[model samples]
Target: MKHVTYADKALFLDDDSADWLMEYARALGSATMTDTVTLRGIGMDGNEVEATFLLNHSTELITQTTQSGLQGPKNDEAVGYMQEQTRLILTPPPARSVDDPLEIS
Candidate 1:
């Protein structure tokens, strides 16, 4: 199975920048990928947050297994493994309110 891991830290930015990161994550989740991808989770600091994504192996096979329960879908497992590791370092958080600034900000 293919594996992809990444991390982000955006605690230095102001509230606006943090919000943008959240939007960016949403966009990324829907973004296209040749392999099966899963959103692990995100860490938040006031308006800032860190996100992670994992690309697993036999994504198409897994999807087919989940949907059809049939094997041998052209054996594109290696292709999935060749996927690039992706990470995004965000600056200038989005426009949003940070509740309990003392804890996160």
Candidate 2:
């Protein structure tokens, strides 16, 4: 498990998920955009819950390994979305040519 600290709130998530979040955040920051991602994790109270994070260029996140024996929550859907978003941000779509209606000869 890993402890992810964001601003004043934090969540404990599985290793893969934690890593994904960190990478996704970096991608978003590089693109200078913002996105929201929800993941299943353990809160400060030691209870499993869904946490939503708003990632942006100004966002700051810190993740650390934990020694807790608890199993991290499985959230394949969220992870997949994050992966796709990160990929898109890193490799954006190619620009298309716009047809102009006005022609001055």
- Residue-wise C-alpha lDDT for candidate 2, range 1-105, written one tens digit per residue: 999998899889998899999999999998898999989999999888988899999988999998988898988888899999988888877765687455579
lDDT of 1 by residue, 12-57 (tens): 3222222233343343444543233322222232232323333332
Ten consecutive residues with minimal summed lDDT in candidate 1?
Answer: 57-66
Error of 1 at 63 (Å): 31
Among these predicted structures, which one has the highest lDDT? 2
lDDT of each: 0.28, 0.90
Give me the runs in candidate 1 sitting further than 4 Å from their true place.
1-10, 33-105
Clashing pairs in 1: 1-57, 2-57, 16-93, 16-94, 17-92, 17-93, 17-94, 18-93, 20-94
What TM-score number comes out for model 2?
0.86
Error of 1 at 33 (Å): 6.3
Residue 68 accuracy (lDDT) in model 1:
20
Candidate 1 accuracy as TM-score: 0.23
Q: Estimate the lDDT of model 1.
A: 0.28
